[model samples]
Target chain A: MNKIFEVPLYAYERSSDQDAATAVRHKVIVIGAGPVGLATAIDLAQQGVEVVVLDDNDKVSFGSRAICFSQRTLDIADRLGAGSPMVDKGVQWNVGKVFFDNRQVYEFNLQPDTGYANPAFINLQQYYFENALVDRVRQLQAAGAPIEIRGRNKVEAIGTHDSHVVLEVETPEGPYNVEADWLIACDGANSPTRRMLGLDFDGRVFEDNFLIADVVMEADFPTERWFWFDPPFNRGQSALLHKQPDNVWRIDLQLGWDIDKEREKRPENVIPRLKAMLGEDVDFDLEWVSIYTFQCRRMERFRHGRVLFAGDSAHQVSPFGAMGANSGIQDADNLCWKLKLVLDGKAPEILLDSYSRERVQAADANIAKSSRSTDFITPKSQISRLLRDAVLDLSEHFEFARPLVNSGRLSTPCTYQDSSLSSADALNGPDITRPGSACPDAPLGDEFLLPKLAGKFTLLTIDAGAPERIEEGGVEATRLALSVKDDLTLELKRRYLGDATGAVYLIRPDQHVAARRDTFEENAFRQAIRRATGKE
Target chain B: MADLILTPNLDSADDFYAGLLAAHDGLDKSASDALNARLVLVLANHIGDADVLTQAVKAAALRGS
Candidate 1:
């Protein structure tokens, strides 16, 4: 085991709130100090919103879980001030190879073109990711941000009121009561908070089990994602190998439905399997071993009155596509800005409803893609297996069949195409930057485009005329003017202005395009800001 | 999108039928099923247009019923 997990980073320290005679009411209380919870708190605190985070544990997670982080996630982390450390400690890879029965079928490059600031994906241990986030929280605290993280403070009961939520928390001292104007539950999949509220997820539970083994070894395998289907070593099942930082390799092997999970996880049974895959001469030590059965499900709604759910507490999917944690981080990204507006009374409370609507749409998309991948990887019926194997076999010979072979589709950022907040798109710009799409990164001399749009409504003007700032219904959108003549790389023109000579884009604080037009008009831009902030 | 060819398009219909039957002559139930799946996939790829495939699938389902 790693030494990082042994030492408590945020040890149990008594807080003044625990000793207060009456239940202390906080502006916002976030449950579970995992990645999503920490991100929510950090985003809120950075915007000067007071938030309190409570967790049942004090240290990072025990194992290298959720090792694959997508570029969109890195972009969000960059805005939160934790991107540099994570990127520094992560293994970046863009190439992935698919193998069938000991022969490589085809390889893919995730990042074919590179003018962006981040790579397509980075492999970092979940513990390191969490530690980076917690470190960011500490930095914010030192800078006098109104955020507090309490360890060993677990909420056991929850009561939803008309205007606030009351929670009965259990700590080392005893049980005490706390109140919050709003509650955000980032507790994990088996969320006690969700259960206390009598909520459940509605979707399919796959009938296959997977064994995840993290081993420390020095090997010569290239830093790329390698997935095998029905290999000789693991006959009739699938296996995935990925490189992580610190010489830790993540290996996932598919185990059929009816097996003793405990026996399969034993080192005695695991070492032989490793020896078969990596020849008998290779020496390695098992760092962590676990078995997981996955489901593609989510809550009916993420927000219920004043209580909200984020991360694994609201949705879950199989680990095949790395969608679980990536989508959860996006949940934090979609939520914090709207929550900030609601708390500050700049926008109507119904604006938070769009968070649930949009994220639930995103969750459904993740679930659909994940479910299809699971079906392709683990065929349920004889006919389905025959078709799947046929695809794999033909892929080795035919170019068209290669696309039919499904290892895992991997994850991409979700675009809120039908979001109510998005105004009519009239720019005829690149589809990648249309209304409701996450703004793709482009080069602007030494800086990138996403960082310039960080955490505020900005009017991104390209060879167009716009005011320095536009205020609508108490929401402000500042201008970020650019010209194609200054873009030596032409990436901004290619990504933002496909055929139009000039473009103006209204970008939300979450870095999603709210509206775009060929040219700026004051009345239209002002109405777009109002629509995006839920004032309309 | 073109409609599925319901008319006689095969140059030698009997010959094609004979060849398909010969392909599955000695195979058992499972092997024959596997072979049929591969053949279907091959033909589907050959007729790559999605609209034509949907029409053919609907026609085949109606015939089966």
Candidate 2:
């Protein structure tokens, strides 16, 4: 077992709230101190909103769950001042190979079109990711930010009201009552908070189960994602291999339905399977073993009255694509700024509705992609399996069929093209960074563009003139002007400017493009800011 | 909209049919079905037009009915 899992990072401690006569009203109370919950608290606290995080456990997650973190997730983490540790400790890789029946079909490199500060994907243990977030929370606490994380503080019940939410929290010492003007639930799938509210989590539950084993060994396998379809060791089933820190190799083997899960997860059965795949001569130690059945599902709506849900509590996807944690961090990124605006009376509560609309769109996209990947990996019907195998067979010898062989369509940030918060595009820029698209990063001198646009609304002008600052309807956007001459690589021009010589873009606080034009007209830019802030 | 080429586009239709049958001559039922599926995918890639594929699928389905 990993040493990180045995230590309690956030052990229970007595608080004054437990001794108070009446319930203490906080500005925001977040349930579950997983990646999503900690991120929400940190973002809110960084923006000067008082937020409290409550979790039933006092430590990071036990296993190496959610190992693949996408580039967008790293970007968000960087803005929250927690990206450095994760990037430093993560095993970064972009190459993936797919195999069919013990033979390699094809390989792919997920290199981005242009340079980015973060890699395409990084494989790190979920414990390290959560520990990094918890460390960031501690730093913020030391800096006097209004953030609190209560360990072993479980919310037994919740009451939703018109303006406030009352939570009945149980601690190791005793039970206490608390009130919050707003409640955000990041409690993960099988969320107790969700059950307390009686909200239905509806979607397709895949019948097959996957046995995940994290083995520590000294091996010669390269640090790349290798997926096998029906290998000899696991006949008629798929398998995946990924490298993590501390010499831990995460192996996932498909265990078809109708097996005793307990028997399958035991070391007696699991060790033999590992030996068969990794030869009997190889020596290894098992770190963790478990079985999981993934479901691609989400709630009908994320926001309900004074309570809102983010991350797995609101949505889930199959584990193949690593969509679960990456999307959850994005949920926090999409939500925090709007929530801060609503809390400060700078924007109406309807601004939060756009969060639901946009994130639901993102969730649907993930679910669709994940479902298709799951079907390709585990075909339910005979004809479907035949078609899948045909693609795999043709892919080994042909280029066209390679695209059809879906091991897993890796996670990418979704673009909200139809968002109400985005204005119509007037500049014919590259579709990759058009209105409602996340801003692709470009090298500016020795620095990067995304870090400069962090945590605030920015007006990005390239050889275009705009005011230093524009404020409309209680929201302000500052200009960050850059000229084409500064971009020696011309990557900025290629990504943000196609044929247009000059352009101005209104960027949301989350770094998504809200609007763009050939030149900055004050009236249009002001209206764009208003629309982006949900004041239109 | 481009429709499926139901007309006489293939000049050596009988030759092509004979070649396909020869490819599947030694295969069992399962292997024959797999071969047919692979053929469909290869041809679909050759004719990559979505409208043409849709029309071809509709025409094939109507014949089956």
Candidate 3:
């Protein structure tokens, strides 16, 4: 009743007569050759840090694992010089349509007024993304900024000593011990690194199974996106379709609970359904089809001694918003600078704790958003479905009901509340632009505000004299006259005035507001700066 | 005077799209008007295309433009 299929391993193997166990010390040892791990490795290598990347997989697995990248991620990739080629291979999309029971209910076109260099989202398969990042890693290696990539080597154990983390990696030749200043585990959802350290990934796994199908078809399709509700694609099941480049498209069908528990999913059951939908005359072949159960979870802590966890190792989001990979990349972007500062001895070890605090906040927020998206997509009960349909109906008629229907709040960066770094005022209340918040993009000349904030931490204050006061407060601050574009008009001053004068704002390397001031006072600014940098 | 002709049993989505396209052409649609119509229609087709929809949804959800 089943056919045996053996997928060939595409990992690279080398014949080495040299001693394999010769302990080599690296500034950073990244475990995982996936996009996040590779992105981390490239950032470290670019900063002149010695690096090594190891993965169990032989080569990049072709799949629609993480096909959607955010504008923020595109900017990050641009900074690393991988954006151009990636953008070439990917499709830029900004429009979407949602159909509820064969009736169009909601629509959104990404008319980004925030003025970011990149558009709202770009689509590219996970495999091509990994290839691009791996290629970047190799380019860095060729430039003498060496990165040792061990494809077949799987990390077995990691022990952090006072100065270094000792890693026992299992290779074909046997187990080999290596040392690194820091060990980053981007290994993935079931991270062996996190398990080895006894870190618990606490969360919930959805009971539903989603069938993802990638097909190559010669049909004239729109460049926009559509999601159908309770469509008769599979009879009482929901289905989703999207257009991709290279004549390929992605399809997802909700396999309802009534499906045979042990149903044999032959090509016969799938192809006929496709033929029925698009007509049998349409030429197409199923490229890949897989079923995945979603999960929403985050680790108790992202850091254990010197070994750190990032990406899926830190948090797992449902595939609903493509939040998992995007959030993971954001984690890498946040942690890279702090790790660099600590490794270079520019900052103390206490700074590492902020990584856990801030990223865990982000991880939690992403999980919540993705979970909500998953819930919205797969209504668990009849009541839930009824409520959803009612809301959709309301949205169509009432102007005030659109936000409730669209649910666009999930896309905003999460404001950190539980982190120890924020001021009492920030932690005590809900404020949009507070300390520990991701400073929203400001307009600069013709470009959106973020391009100017690249590479270094920036502090934007309303009090023109606050930059000098911050210096006196023992904090490093760069005063900028930031013009934020609001509704096609550039507001050429700080959003708040007067009281924020001399109110010091400290920004982190990741451009998050590390600390902020409502009143320009030297001691308070100093204390906030110290807290942000972990000098306190 | 317009003749009222009713056709029954039209259910398929593809058939609907074809009927919609034909009706637009029957009106002798202008190029700019046709472009806007095609934009919406094509986008609808893409949404129903089956390969890229989920990514499109995520992309559509992006913050701040």
Candidate 4:
């Protein structure tokens, strides 16, 4: 195996001159051209790894799926080099309104810049986001990485042997076989790749179905997202409306549990629901209306040997906190860097399993968090409904009760505290370990939120002596001298330095703090470097 | 070929399709039927697919009938 650093962007194919059939075998074959697959491909291409991405669709489609891009996702995107454009295009929403009994019960102002770079959340069209990614993918393809986007090509069969995974693809022209060292599946919830591998996607399916509509409003509606319970117009149903780019409005109606399969075919059934939420006088043009069932399930495992899973392929989280695609993109971010190291022969096979372990744990935690959020939003039981209503009632007077009504916790990233990959020593320390605590998006010197620490490994330490020690041991590390303050939180001073104790923290490319040590004692730094880079 | 005039008053014309709009706006069946006949005629003019247009008028008139 070649040294990872020496691996050229298009190692197998000299240039992008050869037809895909005659093209050389790539280092990685990524299935599905969604945000996760594209993001993983972009990250791998940036690292100079030869990649080929394949999808069934000929062109990107406009859909109302995964609109809310959280600050964490923006931070991850920033590392991939498209954060600024996304931020510029998206509407930054920090406040949300929840209405109970047709009245404003709770208003939430999210604590921005508290964790990771970027804001609370931003709303953008998924199709536009896909276009941006497609452009990036095209750029990488032009650079001679052999990113053959076999649009209208479907993978018929994927067979894994000792060396590489063989993909049998049926393209418009003909059937072709392509083999690669690794395969990453970002093919969404109904992933054929996951099924081909015989991995189990087990969990409860929510009985409730939702009708999502994208409408063009003529009237001036509020920019904030509004959630209403037992809306006056529609009893036993909830209405949610969000403003998107352009004059487009995203309205979701919580249709009852049982839905006729042919309900959407009759547009009249869905149209009235939209009118009830928006006043009858308001003139609007319907862009698209579709009925979708919410499901909360995750794969038992994220990988089968060389074949791996990311996004909805791995887990299907109900869109309660917009966790489905956000978590999926994060999964791609986490898996890409590790796969690069392994393919480059920089890391052992054991490191690959950590992706499965850590991310599966993250997915499990995400599933639970999203499920809890779904239950909170649309509780099934009578007692749970009463408890939910009680919170809305109490939030009127209680200051802290607003968070319950607003529920900002849904959007927060789930940490990997009780995962096998996490070191026990790191959890017990003098300094607060944000192991699962998302890397804060605290503002740096200017208005720049601390730059996303993606693409490469990062070392953040309170010990002023650590960088010197790391350099002494032939290991690269960054030392930030932090002053321990009164609050048990990371403090960004007038300077660039942070606030904390004498502990060393190693952050992964996806911005997950992998390993933290109070003192780098007895080859701990080397072990940590191996743990982070998977070289050990 | 003459200049295809696309000019049409969409505002008041919108009220002619009030039943369809009202149905989407979460209105009851009675008010939904009152404007059904006008809704069918207005929508049939807008629909591009002939088969779909036939279905639209038939369904709307059946609801009113």
For this target, which candidate reaches the highest TM-score against the unseen true structure?
2
lDDT of 2 by residue, A45-152 (tens): 999999999999999998898899998999999999999999999997778888888788888887755668888778999999999999999999999999999999
lDDT of 4 at A45: 86
Interface RMSD of each: 1.1, 0.3, 13.6, 20.3
| Model 3: per-residue Cα lDDT over A128-221, one tens digit each | 7777786777677788886767778877888879778988877777777888889999999889998888778886655456677788887676
- In model 1, what lDDT does residue A290 have? 88
| Candidate 2 lDDT score at position A181 | 98
Chain B TM for prediction 4 = 0.30
Worst 10 residues of 3 chain A by lDDT: A1-10
Residue A268 in model 3: shift from native, Å?
A: 1.8
Say what the interface RMSD of candidate 3 is.
13.6
lDDT string for model 4 (B25-46, tens) is 7656544443343344344445
Best by lDDT: 2
Please give the distance, in angstroms, between residue A168's alpha carbon in candidate 4 and its true position after superposition. Answer: 1.5
Which stretches of candidate 3 lie above 4 Å from their native place? A1-21, A106-108, A159-163, A172-174, A235-237, A256-265, A276-281, A395-402, A406-411, A424-432, A446-448, A461-463, A466-504, A518-522, B1-65
lDDT of each: 0.89, 0.90, 0.67, 0.67
Against the true structure, candidate 2 has what lDDT? 0.90
Chain B TM, every candidate: 0.93, 0.90, 0.28, 0.30
Fnat per candidate:
0.41, 0.88, 0.00, 0.00
lDDT (tens digit, per residue) of candidate 4 on A1-536 = 53221222221222232346552466888888888988888888888888877777655544556688887788877777777777788886656778776778767766565533466678887765776677677776787764556566688898887778888877656667777888889898889998787778887655467778888886887788888877776566677888888778898777777767476536687677677777787789887777777577787778788888998888886666777778877887778877877776666776777778778877777777766666667767765666566666656656644555533244556576654444445534533345545566544434343463555556665533555335312335554444334223444322223332466666666666667766555367567666565454
Q: What is the lDDT of residue A91 in candidate 3?
A: 83
Answer with 2 or 4, whichever has the higher DockQ.
2
What are the runs in model 4 whose C-alpha is more than 4 Å off?
A: A1-24, A108-117, A142-146, A205-207, A406-409, A424-433, A447-452, A467-490, A493-503, A518-522, A533-536, B1-65
